[model samples]
Structures are given as C-alpha cells and as structure tokens.
Target chain A: AAGVIQSPRHLIKEKRETATLKCYPIPRHDTVYWYQQGPGQDPQFLISFYEKMQSDKGSIPDRFSAQQFSDYHSELNMSSLELGDSALYFCASSRMGPVNSPLHFGNGTRLTVT
Target chain B: SQQGEEDPQALSIQEGENATMNCSYKTSINNLQWYRQNSGRGLVHLILIRSNEREKHSGRLRVTLDTSKKSSSLLITASRAADTASYFCATDAHAGNMLTFGGGTRLMVKP
Candidate 1:
C-alpha cells in the first residue's frame, strides 16, 4: 500500500476563496491527522479522525473542517480562506492513537492565500 | 500555551561529532518523542521515550527521560551533514491523546 498522499502540492487563492485539500491514508491505518506549518516553524495539529469520526479538534478556526469517508480517505475543507490560513497543510496517518506509534506524514500541500 | 520547550534554539557541530538537544515539558506526560525535519519537508520520527523508561537507544541515537524533573534529552552520535535539520520534541500527556510539539531545535552539521 502507498503512503499518505495529498493532492495539489501547491495552490494560490485569493482571500475569501474556498479550498479543499484531499488525502488518502495508507491501507490498514485507522487514524488520520491534519497539521499546519508556517514558514520556519513547527507543525501544529489541526484535527484528527478515527473510524470516520472526528476525534480531536485542535486550535483551528471555524472555517476549517474535515471529513473522512468510509474508505478512509479524508478531505480538509476551508469554507472561507483568509491570508492567515496561508501555510503548508500536512496529512498524516497512524495505526492507532497511541503515544508510542509514530505518525506517518505526507509531503504537504502549500496553500497561498493572497 | 505550548507544553514542550527545547533548549538552545539552534545548534552547530562538526561532522563525526555528537549532538545533544534538551526538551522540557510543563505537565506530566505518558511519552516523549523526537522528530526531524529537513528544509521544506515533513517531520520524520526519530525516537520515543516513555515516562517509565530512563533511557532508550536506537542505532546511534540515545534518548533519556527524567520524569521527576520533566525533562528529556536526545543524543545523536557521529552526526553527518545529512543530520542538519530542525528537531522537535512532542509530549503526550496522560489526559490527552494528542501530542503537543515544542518550539524546536535547529541543528546544523558541518561537513
């Protein structure tokens, strides 16, 4: 099975536009996570999904939402993108929500909001 | 506020030398993990040390945890230029399933 895959490696959008990022997790992984990283900064958790349900919601605004399908593919949707939302969005997957297991991450999708 | 904080915001070492980084957390944790991130790249897991374990080793990497003091250290032996990257420490507290990351330690290895 392939690793986590995120679509649209790079995107440029105007303010107030909507952007949807897609992710396909590896086979057999039940947990998915979303993180955002700014330039020269560490990644901050946004949200997570388990068993097609939203498990955790971090310090994200209301404009950000995510959905996990029956097949385990997840989509992160931004209803109204803002300049502050411009950052690298990363999709990650893990076998379970354990402290010891490492989270496998996709390359990331760079969103540019002008 | 962030739970984890790493000392020495940046580090520089010559090739074949050892590099050490420290992380401190404010709350009790179940485990602590280290991650490496190259320029413009996602983070890669390096190692994890549980609260019960005093030390853990994998290859040239050694991690030590002192839960009493709420601190941890990552030591990399024989570092190379490829090891040049930003390293982050994440803490998984007992109450939460999510891991919160520290600011980070930027390591620069000279060849």
Candidate 2:
C-alpha cells in the first residue's frame, strides 16, 4: 500500500528565512494533518485539512500557513523561521468519515533552523 | 497542552515479557488510538478503541479504553526486541479529527 509521502526528508534553513514543506497523502485519503515533534517531546498537532478545507487548527504559529491543493496534497509554508522551529514535521492522512479510522503517517521532514 | 498523559516515562524489559503502557486523557473523546515510532521514524498505527468499546485486540496487541475514567491502556504480548520503540496514545475528541497526543512512553525490549 502507498503511504503518505513527505518532501525534502531533511531541510536546513537560517533564521528569518522561508521554507515550504509538502505532503502527498495516500490515494483516496481526503484528510491531511500536520504535526511537529521536538526532540524528546510528544508530537503536537499543528493543523488539519478535510476535503481541501481547513477543518481544524492547533498550536501552529502565526508565521506558518498551510493549504490543501485540489489534488488532496498539502503544503506547509513557514516564513521568518526561527531556530525554535527546528524539529521533525510529520504529515498524516486518513479517510474522512469513520470515527475509528487511524491516521497513516509519513516518514516526516526534519527541519533544522540554524 | 496535550490532551493525554502516558505513565512511566520509560520502561525496560526482556524479550517475551509483556509490556504495558497507560494513558490518561483530560476530556471526552470519540476514540483513542495507539501508535508506535521507531527512533527517528514515522509513527505506525497500532490500534484504536472507540469510546463505546471496552477492549480491542490486534495480533499480539491489546487495547482497553475506559470512557468513565477517560483512560486507556495498551499491552503488547510476548514482546520482542523489535518492539523497542516509543508508544504514544492519541485521542480524537468530539471537537474534530485533530488528534491530541500523549507524551509517549519509551519501551526498550531486551533480547
């Protein structure tokens, strides 16, 4: 089975720079979710989209924005990046509807802000 | 703030021993899910228990949910060295599909 695919498995950026992370969800999956995991910390929900619409938001920073394209892929754009933003960014996908459907995760993109 | 809190920040056990982890949440949820992550890798979904369900089993894994206490537990039977990883419990609240994760329990299974 094809799993969710994240782009730029590893990214390095400097402070005040801009970066964009992309996620290609599994086929037929209509929901995409973004999460951040800092070293030795739990994963934090950032934002989510359902059927190409923003369905929920969590602790995502104002400098970050995300959108799901018509093809069901999503992109997370971070501007004015800060060193604190360095972490593992994960993308998960699930079919919308069943309450018991589990989220399928991608390998994630490691962002290192220098 | 995360919605769930997992017990035992870390655990070490020998292979063939059963490993168990507990999770407590703050709010009512539609379902609770357990996931495993190997070091520096993506999360792998293990099991999910609906709010109305008391227990569920998959392969060597068993998950129990107690809605009354807003708590859940995951047990891995006959654990192997391959089971060494971080386990996290996530809750899907009535609010939406966003899953709030717990601080994860690190399990090290020795062979």
Candidate 3:
C-alpha cells in the first residue's frame, strides 16, 4: 500500500528565511493533515484540509500557511522561520468517512532552523 | 481540549514480558487509537477501539477502553526488543476531527 510522501527528508534554513514543504497523500485519500513534533514530544496538530477546502485549524503559527491542491497534494509554506520552528514535520492522509479513520503518516521532514 | 495523558512516562522490561501503558483523557470521544514510533520516525498505527467498545484484540496487541473512567490501555504481549518504542494514545472526540495525542510512553525492551 502506498503511504503519504513528504519532500525534503531534512531541511536547513536561517532565521528570517522562507521554506516550503510538500506532501503527496495516499491515492484516493480525501483529507490531509499536518503536524509538528518537537524533540521528545508528541505530534501536535497544525492544520487540516478536506476535499481541498480548509476543514480545521490547530496551533499553526501565523507565519505558516497551507493549501491542498486539486491533485490532493498539499504544501506548507513557512515564512520568516524561527528557531522554535525547528522540529519534525509530518504529513498524514486518510479517507474521509462518517467517522474519523486512521491516518497514514510519512517518515517526516526534519527542519533545522539556525 | 481532550488531550490524552499517558501514565508512567517510561517503562523498561525484559524480553517476553508483557508491557502495558495507560492513558487518561477528559471529555467525550467517539474513538481512541494507539500508535507506536521509533526514535525520530513517523508514527505507526497500532489499533483503534471505539468508545462503545470495551476490549479489542489484534494479534498480540490488546486494547481496552473504559468510557466511564475516560481511560484506555494498550498491552503488548510477549514483547521483543523490536517493540521498544514510544507509545501514544490519541483521542477522536468528534467525527471528521483531528485527534488529540497524549504525551506518550517510552517503552524499552531488554534483549
């Protein structure tokens, strides 16, 4: 089975720089979710999209934004990156149903902001 | 916010011994799920138990949910070193909603 795919297994940036992360969800999956995990911490929800529309929002920073394309692929754009933004960024996808379904996650992108 | 809180933040056990982790949460939920993650890796879904269900078994993994107590547990039978990882419980309180993850329990299985 195909799993969620995230680009740039690792990323490095200086403060005030911009970075964009991409995600390719599993085939036929209609919902995409983004999470940030600090070292030794559980994953924290950022934002989510359903059917290419903004569905729910979480603790995502104001400097970060995301959108799901027609192809079901999503992108997370971060501007003026800060050191606190350095963490493992994960993308998960699932088939939307009457009840929440399990999420398929990617290996994750390790972002290091210096 | 319905965040799951795991007990005994860390556990160490010998191989072949059973490992159990507990989680407590506030608020109502529709379902609860468990996940495992290796160091610096993506999360792997272990099992999910609906709020209405009491106990469920999947292979060597057993999950028990007590809605009345607002708690759940995951038990891995005959654990191996490969099972050494962080275990987290996540709660889905609503349909089509994101899960609230617990702090996670780090389990280390001795070879």
Q: What is the C-alpha lDDT of each candidate?
A: 0.87, 0.94, 0.93
Give the range of the ten consecutive residues with the poorest summed lDDT in model 3 chain A.
Answer: A96-105
lDDT of model 3, residue B79: 97
lDDT score, residue B91, model 3? 90
Give the TM-score of each candidate.
Answer: 0.95, 0.98, 0.98
- What ranking of all candidate models by lDDT puts the best one first? 2, 3, 1
The true-versus-predicted C-alpha distance at residue B97 of model 3, in Å, is 3.1
Residue B48's C-alpha lDDT in candidate 3?
A: 87
lDDT by residue for model 3 (A64-99), tens: 999999999999999999999999999999999877
lDDT of 1 by residue, B1-111 (tens): 278688878999999999999999999888898998887777788898888999999999999999999999999999999999999998876333567888899999999
Candidate 1 clash pair list: none
Q: Model 2: what is its DockQ?
A: 0.76
Clashing pairs in 2: none
Estimate, for each residue in B23-79, the C-alpha lDDT of model 3 and write its tens digit.
999989999999999999899999989888999999999999999999999999999
Looking at candidate 1 chain A, the ten consecutive residues that score lowest on lDDT are: A95-104
Q: Write down the RMSD of candidate 2 (Cα, Å).
A: 1.0
By TM-score, the better pick of 1 and 3 is 3
Query: For candidate 1, what's the RMSD?
Result: 1.6
User: Compared with the true structure, what per-residue lDDT tens digits does model 2 show for residues A18-45?
Assistant: 9999999999999999999999999999
lDDT of 2 by residue, B1-111 (tens): 368689988999999999999999998888889999999899999998888899999999999998988889999999999999999999987545789999999999999
